[model samples]
Target: MSKIYVLDTNVLLQDPYSIFSFEDNEVVIPAVVLEEVDSKKRYMDEIGRNARHVSRLIDGLRASGKLHEKIPLDNGGTIRIELNHRSFHELQDIFVEKTNDNRILAVAKNLHLEEETKEKGKRVILVSKDALVRVKADAIGLEAEDFLNDRVVEMDSLYTGFLEVYIPLDMLSRFYEKGELFLSDISKLPFYPNQFLIMKDVMGSSASAIGIVDKTKVKVKKMTFNQEHVWGIHPRNVQQTMAIELLLRKDIPLVTLIGKAGTGKTLLALAAGLMQTEDFHEYKKLLVARPIVPVGKDLGFLPGEKQEKLRPWMQPIFDNLEYLFNTKKPGELDAILAGMGSIEVEALTYIRGRSLPKQFIIIDEAQNLTKHEVKTIITRVGEDSKIVLMGDPEQIDHPYLDAYNNGLTYVVEKFKNEVVSGHVKLMKGERSGLARLAADLL
Candidate 1:
């Protein structure tokens, strides 16, 4: 059954090459989509870059045939520019003034009407990223869908990179004595190499655990984590296990974590960084920084000094600091922050000029960053410094970023499987109940 997909402005903006995503489905780009693309072609950010890319793509397609007419694609589908849509017909009933949303809906409505008259009754689906656009699509009698390509992997099934398994009591003894445990020996087990294991005795009476440090060892060595247990939180799942691997791993020079807002990406990295820097003195200092994209554009001038200007944007970081310091008093945390000259929490804007060394660097909210920005940050890591980039791709505030193209994704897709790097996708929401519910429902 062939379907007609209408590419909304946001869909194109979300992914310039989204037209190719439907496989062989016919794709229709309304003339209004081009208008929208033209307007954004001058943008300085990712959205602008994507808009320009769309323009180039449509232009290149013209070489095959006229865009105004249906052009056959090598994939067995056709793409055409929908120029027959009336600009403002019946729009007054829905919107007071001419708006982009209404304009897009108007195109979809006209397309749906045209489809209804066709003998085959083709499906006219409007693809967009804006929630309101999808709502308007439904209201105006057109099928709509959000661009899912940019979405992070499922919250529940996002790759944790490691897993835990429970084995029978006697199996533990045989493994301890033999030293090498074969995969066939644990075929029914949910274990993987480099995966942390908590081999608890199946019987409730015996409360014991052995970590699976090296799965290839074949000899089951008893795992131990008396050190990391000092903190109240333990590696409860595979994601945490991978996280522990990245933190304990001094060899991997780079690590990246992608998850939603409350997935404990930043918290775990920060805690491990503090442990390594303060407790073990492995690194000389801990450096934390994030881009300063104000909720909107930042005001040109500030009423107070540097710290005052940073207060609003840095509040989240401060909240983490306050919790870590266990302080409620005003200025007390700042005093501590100042005391530890080893710790630096500067803005990303200032990092351009320096080469950092022998430090555990953490860049938060990295999904809001671009590939170029990530490259700049990574290049600054000099000598023995290990950098951990963590952020929620779904919760990005940047206008230009989507999950596939954000700095986190760019780094992961580019660096995964490299010897000096490790990547973990945190699936479970370890935050409180309300936060997790909001993440799931909202």
Candidate 2:
């Protein structure tokens, strides 16, 4: 029997194409969801864009058949807008509020009761992205679940960009002597381009070496930039070394770095960008941008000009830059930035339609971005531009995204096979001892 999936407003807002995800099942959208989506359609953000997209999609579907009735979808499923069974009497005792969420729950509850009476094995599940909504649904004796179609990988098994492989002690010496090792001669497991390998001694010795899979994918080569310092910053750990290798490689246009707080993700990315832009003159400029997602309570309506208003949000970027520049005086870094005119720090909001060519773009805090938002940013890269997306997936601030489905993880999984992209997940925190302890324990 086909199940019934009643979607909440947040599900559609998170993904406009969620209606087509249920295969051969009935997708029912409460009328209140439309009202909720409509109220957010005018905002200039990702949610508004998704809300408008959902509205357009539902309107297009209506051309095929009446939405109030069963409208057949292309995936052998049916979608309908529930206009009836939204009476609050059924949920008045349980939920006294007549809010939109309550109305949606009432629709789902009525459908579930009706299905229970008529069909034998049919289930009505409320699909939402909100945790509180799921809890309320369970409180009212309804089956509720999160929308799991957007997740690219399980959080526990997320890609770390490197693997530990044991090899014979002789092979480790041979790799050192020859400066490269054929992957076929080592492990039989499949490896992606630019993935790091820690070749340990099979005899349980302390002898080990690090190598990265080359773009050819046939062999693992030594890291070219492992010994080089970028903007006076050196790699503190093996993961940072691998990240530096990818960051300095001009061939790899897309690089992603994932780690916890104080893992030097932003610091390393800024160092490489500065070195490539100011020292090597590889690119025309260094463009640093990040999504403006506030942590905890937001300080609404910052009072200042554009740059001043952006300072609070971009202070972290400036802190790393100051450390790299060793600026001791007030406004010294600002003077340098103004004198060079080659570095641009802006929010990801203004980067939508601009064509960035011959530039090194670093998008910090990328874990707060959605898949579509990241795609839009990547597609804006012009010729000779290398874009690096780095963030701690565990520290996401976006309401609808999680570690498994954020833009950073999504890009890491999707481009792991492509030769033009590389990824590294830094494990150790190098900011300070206390910071590391907090990251691990707290």
Residue 206 in candidate 2, Cα distance off native in Å: 1.4
- Top TM-score prediction, candidate number: 2
Residue 234 in model 2: shift from native, Å?
1.8
lDDT value, candidate 1, whole model: 0.76
What are the Cα lDDT values of the candidates?
A: 0.76, 0.93
Encode model 1's per-residue lDDT on 165-199: one tens digit a residue: 56677777776777545545655554434444556
Q: What is the lDDT of residue 135 in candidate 2?
A: 98
Worst 10 residues of 1 by lDDT: 217-226
Q: Give candidate 2 misplaced runs (Cα > 4 Å).
A: 119-121, 226-228
The TM-score measured for candidate 1 stands at 0.75
Candidate 2 on 226-257: residue-level lDDT in tens? 45588889888899999998999999999999
- In lDDT terms, which candidate is top? 2
TM per prediction: 0.75, 0.98
Prediction 2 TM-score vs. true: 0.98
